[model samples]
Target: MAEDPESGGEKTEDASSRKLGKARDEGQVAKSVEIPSVFVLMAGVAAMYAFAFYFYQNLMGVFQFNYNFQGVPDFTRLEAIRLLYVHTEKILMTCLPVFGAVYLTALLANFAQVGFVVSWKALEPKPSRLDPINGFKQKFTSRAVVEFLKTLIKVGVVCLVCYYAIKGELTEISRLYDNSTGAILLFILKVSFWIFIKVCLIMIVLAFLDYAYQKWKFLEDQKMTKKEVKDETKQTEGDPMVKSRIRQLQHEAARKRMMADVPEADVVVTNPTRLAVALKYDREEMDAPRVLAKGAGPIAANIRKIARENDVPLVEDKELARNLYSHVDIGKEVPVEYYQAVAELLAYVYGLKNK
Candidate 1:
């Protein structure tokens, strides 16, 4: 079991959807820095390879422009500034492909990890982050150690790959001294490209591993303690005690409303002491008799008291009271099966009133 960093309690449960959503809202998500780095590196290498010819042509033009000056021509301040601006513009244009590739790759890599998230809460500054003691502790944390080791391994692997790659090209490199400058430059570019490609392949594997580890670590960090789960449940579903009270209040209010309708009921059928089902019907206004209220136990006793106070007729019928109380709901017309029984009871009450 992992312990919650904040509460120091055992986090025995997986994070709830609400917890994950809240964390996401705060811009906390599983992501590996290595994934973006590797992607950007690969993009830069691919861009450089594709744009090499274009860059060389532009660079050569610039070099020729610098060196192919006619005799000892004018060299004024304005001319110098103009030459600088032109050179700067050409260089920037030559490097545009690599820059664009890096920028787009970075965006894509990050998007792949966490989609598009913008959280002002994440941008907010926290004073706890400025605590020197906390900062010092963080430096020696397990995560920090893992990051440091990962960096070391990456650097070591890249160096070893570069070493083996160059070693394989030693024979070709040795003969470069005897070749033209252009041939030497071409050989160097080829060797560099191959070396970079090998490094990219290695980094790609590492990036996947890192991404998996990061996701696992993020889930672990988000794990909740049992108490926290209950507390969060209370927050979202309302506290059980409070909910019970609300339900009780609702039942009482409905009962009072039902009691108010007792004075208007044609009759109330009772199981004598156990059940009470108050009914109402009007020949001109109602299609059939309807249960105005029904209750058991204390509510049944209360209904009987209200019926007596309102002078509503009370008809004691064990089987009919049980059926009406069990089957009929308040404000609903009695079913056709009970229509004959209800009509007889209402007729008996009307006869009593006529007397």
Candidate 2:
């Protein structure tokens, strides 16, 4: 099919909710991986600081346990293996909480961004992913260029931050040789942890910028053309022509029913050529006269014709017909003001029958 240039070209319209929903279902959400990375890094650094004393105590205890194994100890294979396991357990005890906290932070960050969404569709393999031509286009696209620049900015910022942080700590490094092993270890931890905290804090600003840009871009990508919007609306709500046809059918059925009841009305009032209203009255069955049908133009003409064919009276009092057509409904009593006029008309009709 020949495509309309507008639909195939730039997308200026806002994305429809259906498009957004479909994208979400496909696991195409606007979220930065960097946001979670920053949070996880912060969590790890905070965990390190919180657990520092516990780590120091465990390491000291391990050192003491090794030292207290006085003098004549045999270095058997089983003893070496046992020592390895014990030390490994100690290392895990020192490190596990930080790792766990970082994992939880990553999960929490992801949850805050897109909530709970599991999509195997996103994981499905695509052959186009392996195509070199498509890959080249993807690699050189504007989005890819922005991603590269952002990465470059992050690296440059971190390096500058590291240089300044380390420059002030140069004298501290010189004192490490004279300091106790414990003091040196503590100094190293403090320096690394401080730099880590600074990097995470700085990265947070970049992450926010990236997240906002990604969201804007995602919505822009989802935008549709006028033609596409119309097509989608028709698909969901139904085509206008089909609806109009159904309405025509319904109107025809109603007209037939009204015509069937016209023969039973006591009188049909006409507004000369424009309007007609049929009124039926039965003393035994009703308290007052009720309108059976009313119509304007062609349908009014039909009502008048039906009344003539059935020998039903066609009274054409312009003011009275206009009032009845305008004020009274198809199956209701005339208003109080018109009661005198209607009573006189009915009396005249009865008098004529008596004559």
Candidate 3:
């Protein structure tokens, strides 16, 4: 029942496929950014967890090389540069699995939300987009306010999750000070992994909710006013009045064509006063007699008048006339059942012509 401000009517009609398709071409789709972000975060965390042993080995090797060198390490510029290059390569290798997982997840999540859309139209520059009044209106819209609130809620949720996570591990955190370096590192990893998992789980729920809201909002935005629906119908299907007029013109053209064929007809079968059917047959060119024209009421009168003027024979056969008018279309041969009757009529007309 929401009213369209521009149309001054309720937006009660569902969007037509034409409008929805146009919106999609312009890169308008109901997709939640949170869905991709949450999936990527989860993927990265899972990748890091799966590659934890590899990370540990790499870190240990770097530590031993730097601090447990048996001899004083080479101090030449070349040696220093080589060490830096080796370390950079090791770091990149260590992070590669996590990066790959995040990248693939981001692509898949977006694909799942909106499929694969490459919209150049959305990227086009428009001066209307730079209008200060519209920009100001957009900033203060309900959607913008809702987005602001969502940000605040996410921050609050993350902080609350971190607080609970740390509180649960307070005893273990206190023991970390007395433990070996390896034990402290292990404890930190365990706590961080659990916290990351909890955040991901919460984000998954939020993402789904946000996606639902986005879809609902998209549909609402696509809703059409009654006037819009009517206008679109006219645009796509042509105005009903114009279409009716075209049909009238077509019917007139076809009638004129039918009347023209009456003069060439060898016989005119009539339902006495109401119906008329004109039939013509050529033994050399046609397998059977075809209806040249058929009509009722005013058209029948017209056909009969033309037949009289053209010296065509008028044969009153009520049943045959009704049968031809009802069952046979113009230009189609008479059916097998009517062949004997029509052949007799054709023979009589040809005999009269001989006299």
Candidate 4:
């Protein structure tokens, strides 16, 4: 059979092939990293501490050399050494918050996109996972291109903001040369505050952009082809072959039970071509006529053979046989509407037995 290309190149009627293909296509890694708000908060704290250390070292230099030192005491050496504490503290303080925020944001973004599902099924190693071609395809996809562009934009924006901010502060440096201590201290505080604000605004913008990209990537990855949807439905529900087999087994079991009751029949009625109905009647032992054995197709022919072997009468009643086969089952009483027809058939059979 020529395979339908729309059905994913498989000739089989199984819908799952298309579904599995869709799942594979959508499963490509388009993951996004969400930096948590806690990281930004920690970054802000680290920035404040950095500015404080800068102010402290410069103040220390002024105190050490004011009005009495023979030379500008080595402020450079002291500033450099003190910067070790500043850098170290900044890193230590920010590490937990920044990484924690990143982890939290990643979790939330993933949950929002895919729901809160913890399945080890997806983690199971497969032969496809080892394929270099698959890896290369993932690395060079449109999702990867978008991620690269996002990073570039964030870096460019932050650098531009920082450059403009520092450039505007250069003119204030000369005023600090002849100022009262209070004025110089105030100027340093103002410049530090502006820098902090600029960085915070840039960080906020970057975070928003990251979130938007995360949503877009998630939607793109979840889009499904029609064939994929049908295949998944079959896998999750059940295979048609298995269900059909189950029904066949049930029908065979029922047929055996009905045929076993054939020995008790008084007469077998047949449409000859399609139906056979074995009926039993007892005036004193039973209230109504009952079907002992009944069948159609091959089983119908078998019922007539059994009646012949047992010496039970075989009556040809096309209307009664067809009606009984259609409306009743083996071991069930004949319906009220069939009473007149069945009574006449039974009387004729009994009269023949008596003769």
Candidate 5:
């Protein structure tokens, strides 16, 4: 059913499991980009800290090698290409592990947020996504406004953190000209690392807030209207009237099967009108007589009619019939207390058969 905004208005109902599942299948789930960005930044910085000595030595060697190079390798094209390749290779070898760690951290962060999700629908090209009108609406949406404000706050916070981090090291920065080249490099590295840590910490807090907001937006978008819930329920579970009719037909079919077994019964014990208990005994199969069938009201009348037509003997015992119907189930042995009463009825029915 089409959702008429003027009629029902906004969706106030909570999202159903089916709705959530459909949304997930379409790759619409709450996930924040900040989580992976934060993790990758953290991993890159941590890796740099852990491998600082190795990186510093290799970097120094590359700088020395570059400084000692003589006359651009005789100005040949092949030599020029070779020089470029060697420089690129050295840089890659030095930075490869750090880049790899950052990539791995991003993958793990995404996995933590939404595990092992693969949806082709998310990657499929949709015209709606390219629609300028829809894009404009989304850009001006309340959620977008909040996200933009959050981004501004994060940038401001990181800038403030960086300022404070460097504020303490102004004197060290001023004395950089007097220090040796290696000492100056080390000082710059330490100051940059301190600023990186401060910015990373501020972003971590912002990432958590962004993640929370993403989840809230996801739920709001997935909410269902009352008619939507009802229609979904009907689709998953058949219409009420149809279900009731099916149950009625099932009852009739079962009643017919029970009536067919009444002919095999040795006797029909009845409360005359309200209850009827039909029991059958097999010496080899049963330890005690079982209730082949029992019924009440109209069903009791049908059982009596079927028994009389089949020429089975009828015994009117109100107490015995009531006890059997109440305490015993169809296809189950009667209660122990009713065994004596049932035995006497069976003996009388057998005597009649013998005559």
Candidate 6:
């Protein structure tokens, strides 16, 4: 006897082919962080300070108490007690908005990237967590290199922005010697500008990094090897042998039920070796002709036997028998397509009963 391909020997080849195809099409590592929201929050902080400074200078002017002498003699206290209140108020204003922007941007970035799924499966303790080999593999991967570069670039950009901001404020600091009060106020403005620029640069860089990581992670997670697909299928659906056995058992049970009900049938329609369907009907009790049993192959042979044993009539119209067997179940009404054939079968049975 020829060996079946699905029995065992050829199964490994099927699994291997599936695994290789999936690996070629879908294997990549995911990124681990949110970058964009951090950047937006940083920008928001900068904007807050800029707006606060603008309001402060316009609302409460700097306090200046002066003492004039021939050769630069004495100095009186230039009380900035009111300026303190303005500065604190500005800081608070800047902080609140920055915080709000950070929060909203974080929410949006998180939503856009991973969606709302909050499963703890990834965080569950596994051997992979402690395995140094896995850690080494991840470290050497392209994903790790990209993350390192991203962080380096972010730091570099912020440092460069701070350096230039301070350079621009040098002249304002120098002018403080001649016009002490005005120069002091200008210095404060310059410092605020420098801080704002630094904050903005950091935020923008972080946001860009976040967006890049999100895209990278999405692509990586979506990757799947052929092997992985097959494995997933096996896990979700059971082994082929087990599935086939279950189907066979279910078919056997159905056949036994149909055979038991065959004697109740008014008529058995047969396509000889291929199909058998036994139908039951009553004019007063039934709205339509109902199939009492149906089968193919050996079950069909058994159905014919049951009908003959009970003295129920057997009809052999190939087309009508096949249609009835295909479309109606053992306990259900015949479908519309088989209505005429079933009605004729029922009429023949009734005439025989009356005779």
Highest lDDT: give the candidate number.
3
Candidate 4 local distance difference test against the native: 0.71
lDDT-best of 3 and 6: 3
Q: Show the colliding residue pairs in model 5.
A: none
Model 1 worst lDDT window (10 residues): 180-189
- Predicted structure 1, TM vs. truth: 0.91
Each prediction's total of clashing residue pairs, residues at least 3 apart in sequence or on different chains, is 0, 1, 0, 3, 0, 12
Residue pairs clashing in model 4 are: 16-231, 19-228, 36-101
Model 2 weakest 10-residue run by lDDT: 1-10
Give the Cα error of residue 297 in candidate 5, in Å.
Answer: 1.8
The worst-scoring run of ten residues by lDDT in candidate 6 lies at 6-15
Error of 5 at 348 (Å): 1.6
Task: Sort every candidate by TM-score, greatest first.
Answer: 5, 1, 3, 2, 6, 4
Q: Over 4 Å off in model 2, which ranges?
A: 1-7, 61-84, 282-288, 327-355
Find the 10 residues in a row with the least total lDDT in model 5: 1-10
127-240, model 4: which lDDT tens digit per residue? 998999998898887778877887787678768876887788878886678887667776766776676676666766676677677666554444455565566666877777
Error of 5 at 269 (Å): 0.9
List, residue by residue over 246-288, the lDDT tens digit for candidate 1. Answer: 9999988998898889888989899899999999998788898
lDDT of 3 by residue, 1-355 (tens): 6676887699988899999999999999998999999999899889979988887777777777778879877699999899999999988988899889999999999999999999999999999999999999998987899789889988998999999999998888877778866666667777788888999999999999999999999998999998999999999999999999999999999999999999999999998999999999988999999999999999999999999999999999999999999999999999999998898888899998993
lDDT of 3: 0.91
lDDT of 6 by residue, 104-205 (tens): 876776666545545455456788779999998999777688768877876777677777777887886676677766556656765766666666656655
Per-residue lDDT tens digits for candidate 5, residues 39-65, read 998998898888888778877777778
Task: Show pairs that collide, candidate 3.
Answer: none
Runs in model 3 deviating more than 4 A are 62-88, 131-133
lDDT of 1: 0.90
TM-score, one value per model: 0.91, 0.85, 0.89, 0.53, 0.92, 0.64
* Cα displacement (Å) at residue 336, model 5: 1.5
Local distance difference test, per candidate?
Answer: 0.90, 0.86, 0.91, 0.71, 0.87, 0.67
